[model samples]
Target: MLEFFNDTQTIHFIIIVGSMSLFFIGFYGIATQKNLVKILVSFDIMESALFLFFIGLHYKVGLVAPILDKHLKTFTNMVDPVPQAMILTTIVIGLAVLALGLSFGIEYYKLTGRNDISKMNELRD
Candidate 1:
């Protein structure tokens, strides 16, 4: 059992499965929840899952970080930094969007006295 857990392939598989499950959990929340705050949280969960999936899958057991140094001077044998950078940028953007969404939700709740998506009919003609 320990040996099974020690394999690199098994670790990668676990990461993939875990992230996918997390994404679906978030999707389920978005599909079924009626509260504005809950929906926004669900979206955030999905974003986190994607970040985990991207970063986890790109990692290798032996590859070094993509940093230049005297001993490690080449890009060879180093993990690709593109995915890490992209995920970092995505995380920043996601946080901004999440904050904006939550603020909007708060304002909506303040104006309407409710945050349920189905109850938001103030704009109906």
Candidate 2:
């Protein structure tokens, strides 16, 4: 039983399920919340779920980071670098988008003194 938990496949499954739950939680928050800030928080949560799933899916047991050293002369059993690189790039982009979204929210709040989506219909004009 202990060995089953120790297996990479089992760990991946757990991670997937956990992330999926988080995704649903985020979706619920986005769907039910009326506050703009809460919606943004939910969006972040959803983004985090995707990141968790991607990282978990790429993880392998007993694999080392993709770094070159004398002790690690071969690529065998080394973690793939592509996903890490892609995720790092994605994180930067995500931050930029989040910052832009927050700035928009701040501007909207400043202009109308409201942070609820229902009250921001004036934005259409």
Candidate 3:
């Protein structure tokens, strides 16, 4: 059990499975939820799952952060910083999009006095 838990492959497998599960949960929520807020939340959940999958997959067991110092001058053993940076940028963009979506939802709710997707027929004309 100890050996199994300590294996890098096992860790990666767990991350992949966990992220996939989260993504599907989000997808299910989006598919079944009638409320606009719930759908937006589901979208956020899916985004989070993708972020987790990317970051988790890029991680290595024995790698250090990509930093330069006297003790570690080379970039050889350091973990790749590109994925982390990309995830950070993605997080910012995701937040902006989520905020925009929520603002639209709020406006729609204000105009219609309801937040249910099924009842949103204002744009059907």
Candidate 4:
């Protein structure tokens, strides 16, 4: 089962399908989920999927961690570190955005005593 993905002929296809699946599932949740928190989580899932795809792209047969030390590393070599940095930044930003969104969600719940948007009829004319 897993051996097919290891084959060079199908690695790219596997990565594409897996990453697209993750993205599509996240997109579906964003489009269909009603709860504010659920939507935010879906966005996070999408972000994670992108990061996974990035790391998967540079993945080699036996790559070592890109640590700058005196040692010569290992049998293979290092991929790239830019994606790691970008993913770290993205995860932090995502946390900040999620926190802000949750704060707004809490405020809405407090003001209306409800979590569903359909029931939020206080501001409607």
Candidate 5:
């Protein structure tokens, strides 16, 4: 089992496992749960998973960030910066979406006087 602790392959394995677990948990929360707040939270979890997967795939030990400094003229096995930038955008978008979704959920609860989806569907009558 000690061999599994090696970074050459274990890091990627962990990244995959983490991503899969996140997806499963998020899916379950979104599909089986009826609470709007929970669904939003699940969405947030999914976003986190994607970000983790990306960062993990691009990560490398003893590497520096792509920030340009007067001292560090060139990169030394630095990981890709594109993924980091994309993840940043994704994170911001996720926050905005979660904020919007939660506010909508709150409004929904206020208008209907209930947070349960089943109880809110009496409008057809």
Candidate 6:
């Protein structure tokens, strides 16, 4: 049992399960929440879950950064840089999107005095 718990496959499975759980929780929150801010938060939660999965998927045990140096000549156990770079880009874009969404939500609240999605009614005007 101790060996099983310490196995890399078991660890990977646990991380994958945890990430999936987070994604589902976020999905459920998005489906049930009426507040715009809560929905945005759910989206962020989902994004975080995706990041976790991506990072976990690319990670390798006993691996160093994929940087070229004089001492490290062989690329035998260097971590991939593509996923890390992609995640960084995604984080920047997600930040911009979240800012824009919050600003829109703020404007809507200012205009209508409410932030609930169900309460928004624009057709009657």
Q: Highest TM-score, which number? A: 3
Candidate that beats the other on TM-score, 3 or 6, i.e. the better one: 3
Q: Model 3 TM-score?
A: 0.92
RMSD of each: 1.8, 1.6, 1.4, 2.8, 2.2, 1.9
- Clash numbers, per candidate: 0, 0, 0, 0, 0, 0
Which candidate has the highest lDDT of all? 3
Best to worst by TM-score, what's the order?
Answer: 3, 2, 6, 1, 5, 4
Q: Which portions of model 4 show Cα errors greater than 4 Å?
A: 1-4, 68-76
What does candidate 6's lDDT look like per residue over 53-118, in tens digits? 998877765678888799989877877888999999999999999999999999999988998888
Measured with C-alpha atoms, the lDDT of residue 74 in candidate 3 is 76
lDDT of 4 by residue, 1-125 (tens): 77765664477567778998999999999999888888888988898889888877766655677875677745347867888888889889888988899999999988878887656678679
Clashing pairs in 5: none
Tens-digit lDDT track for model 5 on 42-93? 8888878888999888876557788879988877667899999999998888
Task: Determine which window of 10 residues in candidate 5 has minimal summed lDDT.
Answer: 1-10
**Model 1 / residue 13 / CA error / Å:** 1.0
What is the lDDT of every predicted structure here? 0.90, 0.89, 0.92, 0.81, 0.82, 0.90
All candidates' TM-scores? 0.88, 0.91, 0.92, 0.81, 0.84, 0.88
Residue pairs in clash, model 6: none
**Which ranges in model 1 have alpha carbons more than 4 Å from their true place?**
69-71
Compose the digit string of candidate 2's lDDT tens values, residues 7-61: 8989999998999999999999999999888998999999899988888888889
